[model samples]
Target: MLDRRRVLQTLAGLFLSSFGLGGYAYAWEPAHQGVTRYRLKPARWPEGRRLRLAVITDLHVGGPHMPVARVRQIVEQTNALKPDLTLLVGDFVASRTRRSSDPAPAEWAAELARLQAPAGRFAVLGNHDWWQDERAQKELRGPTQSTVALEAVGIPVLENRAVRLQTGAGPLWIAGLGDQEAFVLRRRPRGLPYGLDDLPATLAMIRDDAPVILMAHEPDIFARVPSRVALTLSGHTHGGQVRLFGWSPIVPSRYGNRYAYGHVRENGRDLVVSAGLGTSKLPIRLGAPPEIVLIELG
Candidate 1:
């Protein structure tokens, strides 16, 4: 008995409601924090010593999407967890498109320096960091001044290198790898020393007796890693950024949804892919809200 006009109006109303909800989710839902906790059991881990690691990555810290205040909050949250180590995988500065970021990299690093990790705070560059300033980066210099700024704040960026830290149990080796596709965006993707990963050199530094924790921005590296190395941590997918019904339509990586988010077991190697705390490209975050990952190693 309903008229055609009435039915059409009803459909329009439903469509508008759906659009508004999506808009709200994109704008505000991402602000909701999701803390993912996990236990990492690596080979050669001492019986009594416990290591807690907090992984924070893909922090496109420019623009209103991830302002300085938010950065401070994230740092504070990490500190509150009292992790023994904090690994900051890259993308420190926002691209030119995001004009609202204040306090810049130095200020951001300063806040990060406040991070207290008895083991240490280490970092590596993400693709976004390398591509933030295309002109300067295209010249093959480095990740620009962000590295210097990070070092100034006492957090060092590690690239295909391993460092030994004396933990309560014993000595633990932590290695940081470069972004696999960092340079491809500037030029043609090529062989080793290609700006992203340097597995051979990085693994060479690991001693036979020491257990290692690896840091990589993209989770694709997880597949190639060896089981001798206990756990690999990464955060590039942003948990698909906006997932629906527990699945996101968009995930930026060569591996598709395989390494999208959370903990994954690949080739018997444990990988924790963080759902990072900041958004990229868009100001929206839905199913995958921002998070500060706390990984406990026993």
Candidate 2:
């Protein structure tokens, strides 16, 4: 006779652990650097202005998944690459549980400042960077505090703004968008130009015919961006965190699977969504190991 009851109990325990401590353990896996090369026609980049943009995002520091030590490793790897520009997309810290051991915001900022690039380093806030609730602001999602800390460390925080830099490639326009999760993350009313970073306002600041590279926390925003922009980068999905058979089962984008991971080109626009280098919420990573994106933009 088969002991069906015993078999079921064993399976249940396995499932529970994978979701609990098992997931957090998997998150400690060493991060990997994923290199992707893109040639953008719309970039109209001057022959000399080809840019190498390295993107590192979703470092949920202090969370059990990515502690301060692991963050140091990520910074060391990034600097070794010697990229032209580095775009940090956001979600610098967020721990959903109270039992987590997190560091002060300044600790994270000091570690991030160690990263170096020739063109410079720029960043935009992620959903986790905002306040947790409408009232208190001292929790994991520290808005003003996070901005001040990062900027003080040399990583200029670009909030709904654009900066034109004279890269070796020529004039380059880089814009940082206000996270679309602005309303959703804070539980505020949704409307245009009020709670979110105004895309129109950000785009309007760029001059005509300049090759533009925009970075947003969420990949879904890539849909609304016009084709004139040469390349758009984002890192909010975490490659679904736990993918099976090479596909993430749960991507956060409003566009669903279309913009889930990797490079997507449509209607004369190019978007590369990095898997990112840390864990969040559940604190586990399976098929989608932590990834640092190195992109050559020419």
Top candidate when judged by TM-score against the true structure: 1
Q: Report the C-alpha lDDT of model 1 over 76-116, residue by residue, as the tens digit.
A: 88898998888998777763442432556687888888999
Cα RMSD of predicted structure 1: 6.8
| C-alpha lDDT (0 to 100) for residue 60 of candidate 1 | 77
Regions of candidate 1 where Cα sits further than 4 Å from its true position? 1-20, 95-102, 188-194
How many angstroms is residue 250 displaced in model 1 relative to the true structure, after the best TM-score fit? 2.1
Per-residue CA lDDT of model 2 for 49-101, tens digit only, reads 56778889888776655777777888898888888898899888763532324
Q: Pick the candidate with the highest lDDT.
A: 1
Question: TM-score of model 1 relative to the true fold?
Answer: 0.87
Clashes of each: 2, 2
Q: What is the lDDT of residue 8 in candidate 2?
A: 30
Task: Evaluate all candidate structures by whole-model CA lDDT and list the values in order.
Answer: 0.76, 0.73
